[model samples]
Target: MIMFEDLFQSTTSVSLLVVLVLLVLQFFYSSFSSKQQREPPGPKPFPLLGNLFQLDLKRLDICLLNLSKTHGSVFTIYLGPKKVVVLAGYKTVKQALVSHAEEFGERDITPLFHDINKGNGILFTNGDRWKEMRRFALSTLRDFGMGKSLTEERIIEECHHLIKSFEQNEGKAFNNSQTLTYAASNIISGIMFGRRFEYTDPVFQAMVERDRELIHLMGSASAQIYNMLPWLGPFIKNWKTMMKNIKENNEELKCIIADLKESLNPEMCRCFIDAFLMHKLKLEESEIKDSQYHEENLVNSVMNLFAAGTDTTANTLQWSLLYMAKYPHVQDQVQEELIRVIGSRQVRVEDRKYLPYTDAAIHEAQRFANIVPVISSHRMSQDVIFQGYFIKKGTSVFVLLSSVLYDESEWESPHTFNPSHFLDKEGRFIRRDAFLPFSAGRRVCLGESLARMELFLFFTSLLQRFRFTAPPGVTEDELDLTPVPGLIFSPPPHELCAVSRH
Candidate 1:
């Protein structure tokens, strides 16, 4: 009893010491920050907590929107010791992400993710390396038919498999998360490793679960707090487990790399991995020492490609499915359009031009889903004064994509999920400048083209085949549109009955 009591006392003392150290560091940080040029206006943050306590970590979108009301479109907020300039709304987010693309193009590695990613990969890297990797990835994916018939054929193939899975459910209520993710992951799997996994493959199953956990864990309130107060990491909930998950995911990617390494042929590259390995070999022959095409980069790039391609595309489709179920009228309109345009024939990407309503509905779904509200942090490469505020070089910037999606000044019914947001009076599909779901400029989403293709093909094919409705006794009114909190704004856990419309 005495030993246990002593251990508890020791723990308490060490925790207090950590707090003291953080407080002192924060004090120095604030003092140093204050002495810099005039920063953007924002609410006063606390000694060490900063604006963390005031913000709702889960629904940070709402919190940021409210703060923008008081702090103007462009304002600063401290996420722990980190100072971030948030660009809110259409005009503000556009100005920062598009107009000042070069200055606001670099990504900042947060403490929570820094250990996991280690400043490698296309998503996290910056400067010339980022440009090189980004260029290669774009070209490779394009060559594989990112927005063309090759990719379209892959989507059509996956849709058949996915539709079969839903059919096996026999119109009963079923949670589609696992199957949906598998289908999405397989698309990237084919692109990355040259083959898709069986839906029942245990390895693929584990990969999906790992990706979901890592994304949710990183975006959790606990992770955010840990990034600010690294001293309190051990005490944070599931910190060790999250780290384990990250390591396991990386290991799995490494294994995939190892398997590919055995049979790589430079002239006949199978997929992204083979292409990268070929590049590395050429670099070696040229004596290009310390090239970014090494194993660390290869593995990280693969992970980034898989994660981004799977989650964003899958989650957006999931939400769109829910919206269709919730608004049967919209779903009916889509089916009618599909049936009218291409009766009994498989829906093609080319059909999208003729199906204006269906296209608008999909766009509105992307806008309303707002999968990523606060985007990954971006850094200013060089100091610049803009909008009467002085932001220093390397100052982290956060773009409120949610603000842009639901900007009152832009959308007529910003808060509601209305397809007219993407349709003009003549009923033609119109692209809004404020609709920056994939964001804008150099740091825009790497898989934007592919994601758009998947969303359209997967969505159209499904609705053309199935009549989505709420489960058993559930009514449309009973359906919840509020998302489950995490890195992506996923729809709540609820089953939907995919009644066959065929």
Candidate 2:
């Protein structure tokens, strides 16, 4: 038998130990629950699956817009463990991308970007490396006549070639997509290699097809899957096939670079590759860090220029033609302006100033088409307190450029195709703050000037020589403005007739 005092002490100790364990468990449970609740107010997430069920994975843009209605401009969505905060509307996107530019300056280097870019290319690199590559690209482009007389000459020559090709169709309706692609690709190829490939060249065709495939993969369900699950992407059957195509394209690009290296002449260096190679040699001599000037960066940068420069300009031109065909009155006005300014002679880039109405029409086409609806994905550089919400480092953000361009408050007739949006009461071409077809901030399209020149020169030249019309049985209403899913948005398949005005 135990004493009564000893028995009471034992009971007290036992009760205290039990209470402490219960308190500790409660604290742990609360901490975990708080973490689970930490995500910004969003649709309820299921265990492991999260909000995947709520999302329409195929129609990403539509799904995002729908979510924005319920969650406001800035809201969080989950792709498994990843939390992406999408910024919608003009004000929210512009504030994050422009006002707080540096804080949200990093690119979300996904699995595919990592594979193709290797983090060395300007588009993918961050911090010091990005600055260095950007500076180099700018300097090189300037040297290569990006905004100079030489570039104008190249564009004029390409415009003539394009006209000839259209004339070959002899008013017979043909898909202008391929012809435009060839012309645009040649412009970048001329800049990169100092030579242009014939549209019929097997190698060139292969490269173009590969580029098209890669771009198609971007923003596709397969691409999202790859980004969400990098480790499993290679093993996934469909992703594996897409990746193989990408790898083949990369290999082909490398082979082209190899050929360029073999053909390099120290005495008479030509083109971007030659200039880059020469620069590399100088850097080697000076013992400078050659990270940005690597052969891989060169190939990737050239590929980037080719992909970006070609597809975007081509698609925009195609859309312009479509609109011109649909609105003959607008086309007639543009043609009159072209005739008044430049006459039957080849259209000059300088004529843009005198052709205000024509310029306005071009602007309208871009606005109406609205390619690149969302700006490229950007990641936060560090923790930022934005609109009372703490956006942690590495959070994915987007600038909804399309929303801004088509914003009802900013645009008079946001839904309509109106050239008056860019025209003043005096009938002069006026630039709008909301007009950002080439994007803005540090990551603005590097080839903006080149693209602008091409669009103006090509459009004016074509208008001066021909009248684009709908193919015989196709009505204006039949023209589709629906865009195919890709990194660079493009119109669905359509064809038009180019009647000679000569």
Candidate 3:
């Protein structure tokens, strides 16, 4: 009887020890899982629809900005099944893009981006291919006088053509969108093909028009829907149109590349294409395996450069003119600065420093226009604990550039077209850290220097010669400040009177 009792006691002891060990493991597991699921706070998502009903995709920038107010800086929103984490305000955006750049560096190749380039271009691709292509493009652009005097001279010459085009308007109300796009596209064309197209060239006009259409279509409501639910691609009208534009543009680029190849000179690198071809030949001679310098990369890179180099710069210039027409007093001040500082001599790139208010006005236009509201979405490369929130690898991140540009903490008058935002009390042009229109870190716009130079030279020169005003029948108040929703916020289709200051 004693022996039986001892065996029962031993069994009881073993059972209790097993229970205690299980409790310890449960405690650790529960703690770790809680940490893992601690994602950024967001509105409760529906089972399948997600936060779709809650958003205004038309003005996505404004919609997301409003959501940030309720959800705080880092938050989540789902479009259908895709969960996107947005970083808002200047502080949060700067920190994520600049401080933890590598962590949030990879391009999130959405269904649309993948369809467009097939993971081939500098803009949408990642890994070793992206790095090599970007480095090559930057170096080749520098060789072709991207930010140097050679480019300035090219812009100056182009400025003359632009001025003559404006002269054709004869101070009457006219839509200058096509002309401006042509001029901007010509600058990039010169670098890409070693020649510029006349504004009247059918090929040039078609190319620019198609690109503008593609950009607009990419931001359409239908396109957004297609992005979320890609199986709807065949049914989506915008998607069909975009694919057609892409195919046509791709063919045109291939033909241009073929012509350039016909007149091959290994020693004389005429332009970007020549430089690329020469590099490829050298690699082949050296028997380098799997070089990234191939025809597909060349075609896609040129297309990327051509579209980006043209649209944003042209759209910003368009906005500047519209703003001048809308606010005559600001226009007067800019003109006064130009007259005082330049006195009708060709406004050189060197003249930027001497004209502070003019420079501030230009800067303000960019900030206020907010051309690219949200940057192309970035993909998180690794699991990161950011701002005390756990973000998993491969999550799509949208850096709301609109939030940063219009952050109340960063700008004294965040909602207004105030050049004083970029000016100090002494009336000097002061650089604002929050001015991030070109974006920051790895995927920042590669053509920033060239774009800046273009803006300064084109703007000052045009303002020096022309006084933009509302159309004769339209009052300044009638001129709408509402932007046409697109991949870029472009000034709505409106006519402006370019009264000659000469």
Candidate 4:
């Protein structure tokens, strides 16, 4: 009787356990289904092609912004099979990148960048490696006076070189792109290698030229196609050219690293490379394995800094000049401020506060240029329910910076180039929350401080010495403001005569 009773109880318990397990499975399935239902809404994506037919790949930022009008601030869009969630406008972008920062902070390394970077470098990396490298770089930059007087002096010196290059035009029509890039490149070079190359150096010119081409090619339609379908790489002409440029640039960087390694002294670190070498040596001596201070990280970080440090700042400065030429009245206001405040003296970083109009003009140029329309996409670090939408972990997110910069709600004149956007009624320079040309959050431009100093010193000094105007036959209206679309929105190829003010 006892055995039979026990057997009955065991059978009952087994049945109950099975029933409980089924209930648990059903609960989870229902939860997951609900979450999927809550996923951000989007235009119906066709199989295989996704939403490719709906998007303008060339002007993706504008297209996404337009889509946001109907789809709401945060919406889903597909590129081929890949799904991207775009965060549009100032409020949405700021919320995603700043409020829920950790959730939306990872860099979404597209197939193309992944192939090139191989999960290395500060630009397109995440986790501890990225954290370590970024922390080190920021510390090193501060040590070298990134925002301090040391950097100010470096930028002021480069201003002289850039001025000399402009003066070579003799008030004649000439492309200022190369010289601007060279000047910008030299600042990063000084930080990296502790030396600047002459603008005329063939090797230096080649490196800068190659870097510029790389930036342009990276934004080409072929590059976009390659990212969506990497198997088509060989057939894509731009892809082929980009790869060649990368290979060449990598080789050049390796050689520079090697030379720096030979003369690295622990007691006296000269620049970024030397500092990195010293850190690596310390790690090795302490028997630390798997250090993030490896050569790949160093080289890739240098490349990231070099490319980013050069391209965007140069492009903005270029656009500033173009805007000055286009609106002579605005230029006159800026130059007038410079003369009244700084009068035949070197334009120093300290002078910005005194020259509010000039300061506003510079800020306006950055806002108007919208140089990096959409920054490198940020990947969701974990599953997040953001603003009532379920975003799965690892989902790629595009913060449409163009939308933020040109948001109708954010700016008084969203479509016009008005310096007063950054100025108050009292004619004092006012900081606008929408001014995010360097982006924000964890992955904000690492060289922002340096870039700021460079812009103020370079722009002010140049304005102090010369007046930028359209070329001989070109009218201000005729000088094109159409941006050459790329990873950057560079002013279209045009000439401006830097007529000497003196």
Candidate 1 wrong stretches, greater than 4 Å:
1-37
Clashes of each: 0, 0, 0, 0
lDDT of 4 by residue, 450-500 (tens): 898888888888888888989887788898887888989899998889999
The number of the candidate with the highest TM-score is 1
Candidate numbers, best lDDT first, in rank order: 3, 4, 1, 2
| Steric clash pairs (candidate 4) | none
Q: Can you tell me which runs of candidate 2 are displaced by over 4 Å?
A: 1-41, 235-238
Candidate 1 on 167-237: residue-level lDDT in tens? Answer: 99998999987888999999999999999998999988988888888888777887777676665566666
- Colliding pairs, model 1: none
lDDT of 2 at 243: 67
The sequence of per-residue lDDT tens digits that candidate 2 reaches over residues 204-268 is 88888777777767767767766765644645565665667667767887887788889889998
Write down the TM-score of every candidate: 0.94, 0.89, 0.93, 0.92
Ranking by TM-score: 1, 3, 4, 2
Root-mean-square deviation of every model: 2.7, 10.7, 12.1, 11.5
Query: Which prediction has more favorable TM-score, 1 or 2?
Result: 1
Kindly give the stretch of ten consecutive residues in candidate 1 with the minimal lDDT sum: 1-10
* Candidate 2 lDDT for residue 302: 73
